[model samples]
Target: MKKTLFDKVWDAHVVNSIENGPQILYIDKHLIHEVTSPQAFQELEERNIPVLRPNQIIATADHNTPTQDQHLPVKDLLSRNQLQKLSENCEKNGITLYELGHKYNGIVHVIAPELGFTQPGITIVCGDSHTSTHGAFGSIAFGIGTSQVAQVFASQCLLLTKPKSLRVTVNGTLKKGVLPKDVILYIISKIGTNAGTGYFCEYAGTVFENMSMEGRMTVCNMSIEMGARGGMIAPDETTFEYIKGKEFAPKGTEFDKKVAYWKTLPSDEDATFDKEYFFDADQIEPMITYGTNPGMGIKISETIPTLDDASFEKSLNYMGFKAGESLLAKPINYVFIGSCTNSRIEDFRIAADFIKGKQKAENVTAWLVPGSKQVEAQIVDEGLQTIFEAAGFELRQPGCSACLAMNDDKIPQNEYCVSTSNRNFEGRQGQGARTILASPLIAAATAIEGKIPDITKYYLN
Candidate 1:
């Protein structure tokens, strides 16, 4: 029987299986964060369960951590208490933690991949929804609920019914200005949010194969938005190269041995998927979300789709956008350029390349937040910070700034913001704040022009 990459990784991690029922899957890594881990930790404490395999657990402070003033104490009481609680829980449980101000500190999804804690053929679980980001390296990674977090803490295994397999293939050359963010936004827009329900999606074909490891991560980061259990890409030389010298990666001979194993984790040529979708890369362009949901997307050059559904009308009403209207030149007052889906060095470099000598529009309040301390250092090292500063953009410390309204950085009510974060649901940035999801390039251009720009004009000249 030919096994798909998902089957290969998943089967290898199965600890036990009930005939015709759920399987007990061993979790190779358990990642925790301040927001969701507290309840789980309390649950474990209440039940008198010791954290099993503390070495397998990694904790970070994000989601609720302040993005600015790292040296000062956190100002938000709830955020401060949650972060403190997380630190206390980790200390008590003897789990490794990357707290705020720690050099390794970052969004749980971002830091793990950068440090090589996320690797091929592993089963990774986090309380956060974007845990699928680690699947870029051919891993079977997914998010779990609070009870599942406690379950993992107790036994490091999860009883789950196997998800059906799906494959999304995109062939041909991607047009200029199209980033992995745009590709995913385009996919969800085409397939709708419910298309991948009950399936593990494997991203295959030349477009994905040609993408950089960071790009692959961006693609997988939003898989959950499409209702997939998770998303994965096959391990290849690119995967090995990205993990080669990472902090937690295997050393020297061990790396070579690991790569040999990873090479065999790809789906067999004869493997079949339960469902498949094919797309032409040439048809994809820089994409942006128009309505409240991620599936309500349109090419930058196209007008919004006129639909006759009540939910669609409600979304349009909330966004203050009418059907058949183009987003070009729609005045925007805010721009956010960091999140787990982006916020890597490559994303900063791309923004800086466009922002080099240009100045931000007087009307735009732009914020460039790095995903991790390491990425922050890279921004300074590569002088990307200088370019952004010169353009009047504020560079903030690492955290999930404005991606959610948990921190100080926020988009004011009823204002428009072109953001690089994954979701654009109503009030995702702040109470009543409107979010327009786009690639870093689109976000950068929006800041430069103080509104949405004609994306077709970008990277074409």
Candidate 2:
């Protein structure tokens, strides 16, 4: 029987099926971090259970770790306790951990792929919504709650109901300055945040085929924002190329064998999806969210929508934005270009190349954080650090900096920030903070202009 890519992977992972309940799906890789695993570890301790497969689990400290002064102890009391507990739990359970100040440490999602721990035709689970980022390599990866994290640690398996498959295809050439981030923001706007409920999305089309691995990861990382269970792009030559020579990836003949299997993981020609959506890549412009929700987005050149719905009105009020107003030239106080969603080397390269020899607006404070230490090293090697310094931007230590309000990187209340991170919900960056989510290019241009500008004019010309 012809099967969609999701079916091919999910079915392969199903160890057994209950009569009228969920499937017992085997997880090949289980990732944990500070925020969610503490409770799970405590639960295991109460039950007097040892981690059934310690080697299969990998822990990292990112969510609550400070982006600066990593060598010193965490200043926040709660953050310090969480990191300490995570280290203790991992040590007691015999699991590998990438602690703070460790060279390999980074956001769980970022480090997993960079280390080649995320592979095609496998099942990966993490207590992080952005775990979907690993699906860029054609794997079945998704987030789980604390209980589910405990379940995986105890048995290396999860109970899950099969999700319906949705195929989203984007064909044609993307216009200049229309990045993968713009493509996803455009999709969420058209489909609404709740449209993909109970569905796992398979991204297919010429546009996705031509996208780089980092671009694919960016698209999949935002799958949860649109209510999808997860999103995936089938493994191809580009996927294999990215995995090759990575620390955990298969080598020599083993790699060749793995590639042979991965090559067959794409959806068959006769496979059908439960739902399908097609987009014209040419129509997608550089997108930014004007309202609180990620779905409340518009093209950079478009005006805010004047909807009669109360929710729309509430969003505009929260954002201090008026209907029918253009975002262009709206003054911004902060510009953040980092996160699991857009802090990869490719993202920094785009921003650095654009900001070279240009100075940031005096009124704007810009933060350029790499996603991982490896990415930070790459930046230094490529001389992007020099360009950033020349442009009046400072490179911060790697972590989930400014993506959330967890640490000292929080944006001040009511201050508008052009950020490349995911989500623009009310107070997502800090209490009462206003977030304008955009691509790295848009963020960099906004920093240069101290407001949202026509990025095409600033960079392309």
Candidate 3:
């Protein structure tokens, strides 16, 4: 029988099927983080259960860790407590943990792929929504709630209903300055946030095929924002190359064997999808979200929508934006260029290279945080750090800084921030904070102008 890439990976993970309930799906890799696992660990303690597969479970502290002062003890009471508890939990359960200040420590999603823990034809789950990031490698990966985390720890399996498959294909060449982040923002805008409900998305066509593995991860990371169960791209030579040499990836003959299997994981020619959508990549521009939702986005050159819906009006009011207003030249108080979505080395390289000979606008306070310690090290080795420092940008330590209002790094109340992180919901960055979600290039350019600018102007001139 013909199967989509999602089906090929998901079916392989199904351990058993219930008569009329969710299937018992085996999780090949279970990732836990400080924020969600504490409650889950407490639940396991109450039940007197030990983690079933300690070796398969990887833990990290990122969400609540401070981006500065890695060598010093965390000063925030709640953040410190959570980090300490996570370390203790991992120690007690015999699970490996990349604690704060550790070399491999980073956002759970970022370090998983960097260490080669994410692979094709596997099932992965984390306690965070961006777990869908791993699906970029052609794996079946998704987020779970606290209870589901406990379930996975107890049995290394989950009960899940099979999701219908949706294929989204984008063909043609992207125009200059448009990035994978823009591609996803454009998708969400056209399809609305709920278009992929109850579906696992398969990204296809020339745009995805030509993208680097890092670019693919960026697209897949935003899958859940559109209400998709997850999103994946079929593994090809690019995927193989990215995983060829890493700490957890298969080596030697095993690698060859694994690649042989991965080659067959793409959707068969005769496979059918429950729904399909096609897009022209050339039409996508550097995108920005003007309203609270990811789907409330427009091209950088476009004006805000003047729709009559009540919800639309509320969104504009919350954002302090008016219908038909152009975002260009709007003053921005902060600029954040980091997150699990866009803090990889590739993202940093793009921003650093752009800002090399320029200085950040004096009116803008900018934060350039690497996603992981490994990425931080790479920045130094590649001399990107020097460029950043010379451009009046300071490189903060690795963590999920400014992406969420979890730790000390947060946007002040009522301030507008041009951010590369996903989501622009009210209070997503901080209480009363306004977020303008854009690609890293857009964020970098905004920092230079102290406001949102037509990015094409910078490229052209």
Model 2, residue 264: displacement in angstroms? 0.9
User: Where is model 2 more than 4 Å wrong at Cα?
Assistant: 459-461
Model 3 residue runs over 4 Å out of place are: none
Q: Model 2 residue 285 lDDT?
A: 89
Angstrom error of the Cα, residue 336, model 2: value is: 0.7
Clashes of each: 0, 0, 0
Clashes of 2: 0
On the 0 to 100 scale, the lDDT of residue 198 in model 1 is 99
Give per-residue CA lDDT, model 2, range 1-461, as digits (tens).
89999999999889999998889999999999999999999998999988999998888998878989899988999999999999999999899999988888998988999999999999999998989999999999899999999999899999899999998999999987888999999999999899889999999999999999999999999998999999999999999999999989999999999999999999999999999999998788899999988899999999998888998998899899999999899999899999999999999999998899899999999998888889999999999999999989979998998999788899999999999998898888999999999999999998998888887675342
Backbone clash pairs in model 1 (N, Cα, C under 3 Å; residues 3+ apart or in different chains), count: 0
lDDT of 3: 0.93
lDDT of 1 by residue, 1-461 (tens): 99999999999989999999999999999999998888888998998989989999999998988888887899999998998998899999999999989999999999999999999999999998899999999999999999999999999999999999999999988988899999999999999899999999999999999999999999999999999999999999999999999999999999999999999999999999999999999899899999898899999989998888999999999999999999899999999999999999999999999898999999999999999999999999999888999999999999999998788888999999999999998899999999999999999999999989987765743
Worst 10 residues of 1 by lDDT: 452-461
- Candidate 2 structure, TM-score to reference: 0.99
Stretches of candidate 1 off by over 4 Å are: none
Question: How does each model score on lDDT?
Answer: 0.93, 0.92, 0.93
Models ranked on lDDT: 1, 3, 2
User: Which RMSD does model 2 reach against the true structure?
Assistant: 1.0
